[model samples]
Target: MRWIAILPVLALAACAAPEAPGSERVPAARAIERPFDVSTNVDFILVDKSDRTLTLFRKGTPVRAYRGVAFGDAPTGHKRFQGDERTPEGRYRIEYGNPQSAFHLSLKISYPNAEDRAYAAKHGLSPGGDIFIHGQPNGSPEGQKIASHWTDGCIALSDAEIEELWQTVPDGTPIEIRP
Candidate 1:
């Protein structure tokens, strides 16, 4: 008799909706159109500030591209100091991943390279750090959209795109940003 009573509760629990992974807050909109293929090897990344695109390359050949990417509020010129609101230009590397970020997900960019540091040092300004490629702000409601260039200095992508990148891009991948 007890077994029969417990079965209905188990069935009810099973019918409940499952939670989305990676974060406690979920978006109201469907972000991912398709899943990423993890087998593809991504060795390089390129960001074109003018075009607002981020492209992934496999062994020098373009493999994947994300369009309508967002950048800093200023969005012009190379980032020289903290709070400049400009994305850095030149070569850098993907240093690590942040699954618990305020954004949906993120990949840290190695900014403030030697040249960047030198310039900031010479000018007595702090070269901003903690630059990353990230998704929309966590808990964003469905249909809410951010501006084209809204970040303080980091690059922004769609939640789905960043999820794909979080799976595909590995640490130490070279990245080049162009004006």
Candidate 2:
């Protein structure tokens, strides 16, 4: 009985060992790099909750903004369960981008932070991970354009918008999402 639990632990340890130096090892070194280094030093972030939008600014100027499509059905406050279909409301950063995503383009979001994990643990459920800001799926671009609330919990942008974002937003840029 106890041996069964040990097997998974060993498997997890074996998998985790190789990823130590990828990013988590150093806090500042792995920060995301946005494409646009605005002429002005960006100071704050802007999230248009109602419109499901997120913007990056430099020195009070809008360097770039993304008109994303948010969670579909009854998207609410912070994400709680595995399939809540709600975009989380909090302070987070862009960790990375996925060039081979199902979506035309994709950027990884830092979800399931300490607070999120803790909340899920307390509630005896999953906080639902793998949230990201990405483009429409390969064949669903048209469908996405025609509808709102699509992704599981990530912010999505139009093909053109994602291209702009890809060039303007760096990996380490800070992002804030609000309701």
Candidate 3:
């Protein structure tokens, strides 16, 4: 009879089981507006490495700017080779969306364009790829402390911020990264 009585408690406990492996864990929810209501369209994205600001523009006007973005751990100069721990500089595009990214959600950056490839070839190095604007990694407390640089070679935004970016920005959007 005691075992039977414990069944209900076990069932309730299952509701709080640990997150599964490969789960896309996002931070707390925030109030974000719909894309259409926010603006007609996104014209371009500008990332200033010196200021660590990612701004969205529409028709040459600044629509929104996400501040306190984290960068690669070794963000000193242009990324030359794979594992450089530096964000690449130049023009790129949001190539795709990853709904199951390790970092909550991510917008893929089309790094290693022709120029990047050529430059790498000249130096006999591999231009690292898989760059993205991503949210904080799942199960990481570091998400809350994003003022400091802490990426492998990608732009890191808070979970709430990335959610807004994911909904507002579209693929093929041109992004200019500068030093």
Candidate 4:
């Protein structure tokens, strides 16, 4: 009789427990492994800085949306010079994929396009390159706590998210990062 009386208290305690950051509360049995088909035709990618959402689109239709994206440590304004620590807001393409990136997985963004270079040259500043959309920081624990913004000047997603992206996104896909 006492055990039965305490069951409700234990259940309440479990309900009150805080969920991990960046995790969605869903039943394990009902969780879908791959929310969207990677092989589906994804035409473009959009990153809205204000919303911190990276959405994949196919023919102007949203296919998948990944939330909880983090930007650079100093995530205000456009990156104009080297070591700005700010994500550049511009139109870019997935130039390549780095299977050997220090980050878990990475897809290179074609920064410093002709316009970017011209703008930087006009200002006599170096438009730092090597921008990417990648996974977590190197050597981070699988369950490492992620903050809203923590990167040099790149777009960041969870390791699992990047892995899925790596498989889904292909080279030359257009990405528009909007402030």
Candidate 5:
């Protein structure tokens, strides 16, 4: 009888817990709109290594700028392997999007291109992949506001950011991750 009271507490925790491995995580119940709409093709992409900013543009002016967490350790070049936490510095594309992503939502950034793969192979290593601009792990949207660097080998954004980017960004958009 004493343990029966604890069941409700456990049930609430379960509902608030992060998504489990191989589990599908979706956006929040209240859907939000995007700040700006970006087209699929871009004239060019710019990344300021000094500042942790991912900017999108059509021609010369900035259409949108997102505050992002770059590689924890000075994002210099392509990630050689796992645990590096280095956001690749290169020209890539948003190959796809995931509505059922573990991080709530994501815009896939194409990392480990042919040259990247070849470089990793030449050095006898695995060019880290699955690097994306995604939302926080689990439902910890608030936790991300306090994070200073990377841990999941991908660029992380606040939950609100993920939703904003998800709506504004289109598939096949060019992305440039800089150091």
Candidate 6:
């Protein structure tokens, strides 16, 4: 009887215990205070896959640049079809923002615009979609670094960087993904 009464106290203590080192818990979202104004919207986004860079531009002037961005495993040429494992190369748009993403926050990219669909249809293949500029996978350890290109067909940035980009880049922003 006494042991049964102690169970609730032990459970509470366990709940209050500090997380283990290198825990895979998703970090809580914190307000990012940057030197630049977060409200300043970026007019364009340029992704250079060969150089592994993502640059944000306002009025045709570069405002911010993120280097060492990750891409799909293949990481070369335009995405041709579903399961190509290649990031698309061409102009697209930031269609929407996803606050509840499997990989932290994400900004959806508008892929398969007419031409892409026609190409895939010509070959009788599916033009896979759901590409985004996103952060690390959900529940990834804080500050974990990606050593190689590892996305399916999307661009990836650091969590903090994605948070900043999410705030500065609005929907309908033109994005050019270059080979």
In candidate 5, stretches whose alpha carbon ends up further than 4 angstroms from where it belongs are 1-45, 68-76, 141-144
Task: Please give the range of 10 consecutive residues that has the lowest summed lDDT in model 3.
Answer: 24-33
| Error of model 6, residue 96, in angstroms | 0.2
Q: For model 4, how does the per-residue alpha-carbon lDDT over 1-179 read when each residue is reduced to its tens digit? A: 89999999999998986854422322212213346887765778888777777887677656677777899888888877778889988788999899899998899999878888888899899899999999987899995638679888899998988987898888999988877
Q: Estimate each model's TM-score.
A: 0.77, 0.69, 0.75, 0.78, 0.68, 0.80
- Write one digit per residue (lDDT tens) for candidate 6, span 106-153: 999999889999999999999999999999999999987586899999
lDDT against true structure, model 4: 0.81
Better candidate number, 4 or 6, judged by lDDT:
6
Cα-based RMSD of candidate 5: 17.5
lDDT of 2 by residue, 38-156 (tens): 34334445555576666666654555655545564556678877888878877777787788888878877788799999999998999988877777778874645635776777777
Q: Tens digit of lDDT per residue, candidate 5, span 1-179?
A: 97999999989988996754322322121222344554344444445545766565665556566554444454665576756777777778888888777876877888879988898889898887887878776676464553576544577767776776776667877776655
Give me the runs in candidate 2 sitting further than 4 Å from their true place: 1-45, 66-68, 141-144
Candidate 1 global lDDT: 0.83
Name model 4 segments beyond 4 Å from true: 1-34
Better of 3 and 4 by lDDT: 4
Compute the lDDT for candidate 5: 0.65
For each candidate in the order shown, give its overall lDDT on alpha carbons: 0.83, 0.67, 0.79, 0.81, 0.65, 0.85
The positional error of residue 7 in candidate 6, measured at the CA in angstroms, is 88
Most accurate candidate by lDDT: 6
Return model 4's CA RMSD, one decimal.
Answer: 11.9
**Order of the predicted models by TM-score, top scorer first:** 6, 4, 1, 3, 2, 5
Candidate 3 backbone collisions, by pair: none
